[model samples]
Target: MALPGRSVMPTLGWRWLLIFSSIPSFLLLLFYSMVPESPRYLCMRGQTSEAMDILEKMARVNRVALLPGILVSDKRIELDENSDPSEAAHLINVGDGRSTVVSELESKTGAIMALIKLLSPEMIRPTILLWLAFFGNAFSYYGIVLLTSELSRGSSKCASYPILKHSVGSSLYKDVFISSFAEVPGLLLSATIVDRLGRKFSMSAMLLVSCGFLLPLIVGQKEVVTTVLLFGARVCISGSFVVIYVYAPEVSTRFLV
Candidate 1:
């Protein structure tokens, strides 16, 4: 997609690409201030009024009528030093004027409060698993993307491959452009079946299918076959990424008691 612009401005092309790539981050910085903070985080910080305001805003935006006193916070919080530190903080809800314990966590806010919570006994296993999943996906996805350029430079053995005969010395951009299209279908596939198959099943199935496609590449094959395998692998990997990203945020909030 960016190849055309890069090809036009040969000298400053790479610089322009780098600048263009940063536009999304700049836009996020400019507009993120208007976005409301997470209501759950606000409530945990004893800022229930602010959280309520944000929730009201959300309700209004969605045109949903909100009941009065739906999210009241009780000012009372009891601290017990002898108790586990994880149980140090308490969030009390007095919705309908009936007091109830809504949630609890470590009250002290530190730079690494989130990390501390994630590494807690309850969250540690899933946190580690999520980290490993993300690391493996990123490593494999980029490794395959980088390998596409090398594959495009067909080897002498690939001379017999009809698909590479005409475009044996194709540029890196051409191969990238072709392989990148796989992401479109990959995204569509995820969106279509993620809900039906569920996140765990969807991710596992995609990873397994992607692995199946990748395994065949170990043996020498026709360049056309290799290209097809690469495309298929990219598609499955892209789908897995969609599922994992959706799963990431849910991991933190869902496990909270």
Candidate 2:
């Protein structure tokens, strides 16, 4: 998306992509300024009155009003530092009537123990495979994505001579723009097919299709045919890439966390 606009701007002999990119940054800054500080932060500092005021303002903004006596003072309330941090942070409990210490040391130790457990022979194989697959996919995917423009230009076979002659010619900027626009359909296809087909099947199918498209480029072909095949390969790869992001988080174990 940023690529298309940036590429076209330069083709018009303008160098204002940097300027236009600031629009969203400025809008986010303005939006964030209107939000209030977290109420829990105020309450932690023993500013109950200020917290209540902020909560009331929130209700009003949402076109509602605070209930009477909702913010009643409790003189008998006791603050205990030893209490569970989650309980203290929220000032509420919605669990079995049990309190467990979750200090920094305990948290770190739990993570280390989980790591140790995953190192056992039975668990190690799958863990190693998962990490290797993820690492390989990420490394190759990002390398290809970042250097697609460079690869297309430097490779004598892929470069489009006529397009290179024009303003929107064979360059990283133009390739990026075209690839980004092509991603719209890729994203849509991912959304539609991902749930219907399981993650592994979808990923494998897309990867296979991408490989099929890529093989033609490697084997050698007419320039127009190669260009079209490359575009198709990009679409297949991009769709698979998006699906993997959705799949990884779902399949990751507590140890991976």
Candidate 3:
């Protein structure tokens, strides 16, 4: 969509694209006040009443009744590592000869404390894996994007003409635009298979498939074939990227960023 602008007004077009891209961020800022605060965070900070109110509001919005005694204040609960991390069950032991089962809540800790918790024995492995996964995704995604120009340079239709100075730039943009469209299908595929196959399997599968798409590029091929393979690889890598984002949050309930 920015192509027309770029063609018509080369200098200002790129700046306009950036300005338009930031519109979503501005929209988010405008609407942020309407977004609800995390009830879990509120509870973690010992604002039990606020959390309860939020929960009640949520229940009303969902047209469901709030269960009585769901948010008893001033309770210390120890999370068991062996327990299912997905489970939100928080055991509240108030030391009054009574116990209640509710959603988990931890006392608000400082950034250093949170970092320590993330690096603790139980969390270290997943933390490292998440870091590596994010690193790989970002590295590979941008590498592939930047690689488009280099890959197309040799195959540029304008290469033989030698007369069209702007042809190379236009061809590069076209290749980039085409490759970017692969993400649409990638997103659809991620959404379809993520729930059915689960995050770990989905991410691993996509990465493996992406590798398969990339391996053929080791040998020389025609321009069309090369672009097709790159498109396929991008689709898989993009899907894996989506899965990683979804998986990261599920890995730790406490580390809600």
Candidate 4:
């Protein structure tokens, strides 16, 4: 659906793809409306009755039975004292002791000040590198999305490429739909490969492959070759982008995560 919109709009030289992209926006709004608040959230906010109701509904949906006394009032007791030093002593030493240190620091100075501390000499370089990687990946990903029609436009090696004479008019909406649909496969592929290959390897490989595909367009005059290369580049980059989104947060420190 998104593919046809993206493909057709640019081919016909339409400028309305912007408007057509709203279809997904509206669908997202509709879907979001159907979702109920999490039972955990309700419990946290002191709405035990409502949380119990949601839990019961969830059990029904899963074809399971709610055990008697399952939602007892005592079960809702908050663990405010669990953060005591004696309680956390063993767990504090489990990793690099960094989590414990950060927790103590934040407790003293609050999170914002602790974050500022992380920007000092010892942490600054790694922090900057991570930020740059995230920024570059995001910029490239969104750059492609916003310029898909333009990227798909123009001549390729074929006598007349599919998008050569495309207009940016009525087909704009359709083009956006088509392009968005095309990303689903890429997203699914990233999900499958990231865990298998390791996040860094998968992401770096995809970005390198994407760059390889795009390199041809810089030197090749044939419209067909350029078109094919651009399409491949888009897919590779988009897949890498998806992998990065998952990997970045996972690799961050507990505090950062």
Alpha-carbon lDDT, every model = 0.72, 0.62, 0.73, 0.63
lDDT of each residue in 1-257, candidate 3, tens digit only: 55664466544544655575566679899888888878766664567889898998999987898897868656434546674322244435454333221211233346568889899898898899899999998888887887777665554342343221344544555566668779879999999999899999999999899889877666566667777888998899999999998998888774645
Better of 3 and 4 by TM-score: 3
**Model 2: per-residue Cα lDDT over 21-135, one tens digit each:** 4566688887896788776665655567887989999889778867777554332223487643333353433244343344445667988987886776766876686676577
Clashes of 1: 0
Sequence-dependent TM-score of model 2: 0.54
Candidate 3, run of 10 with poorest lDDT: 97-106
**TM-score on alpha carbons, each prediction:** 0.57, 0.54, 0.57, 0.55
Q: Residue 207, candidate 3: how far off, in angstroms?
A: 0.7
Task: Record all residue pairs in model 1 with backbone atoms less than 3 Å apart, i.e. clashing.
Answer: none
Error of 4 at 132 (Å): 1.7
| lDDT for position 190 in model 2 | 78
Off by over 4 Å in 2: 1-102, 156-170, 219-227, 254-257
Instruction: Using lDDT as the measure, name the better of candidate 3 and candidate 4.
Output: 3
What's the count of clashing pairs in each model shown? Answer: 0, 0, 0, 32
Residue lDDT tens for model 4, 213-239: 756544434435544555566677778
Q: Candidate order by lDDT, highest to lowest?
A: 3, 1, 4, 2
In angstroms, the error of model 2 at 113 is 2.1
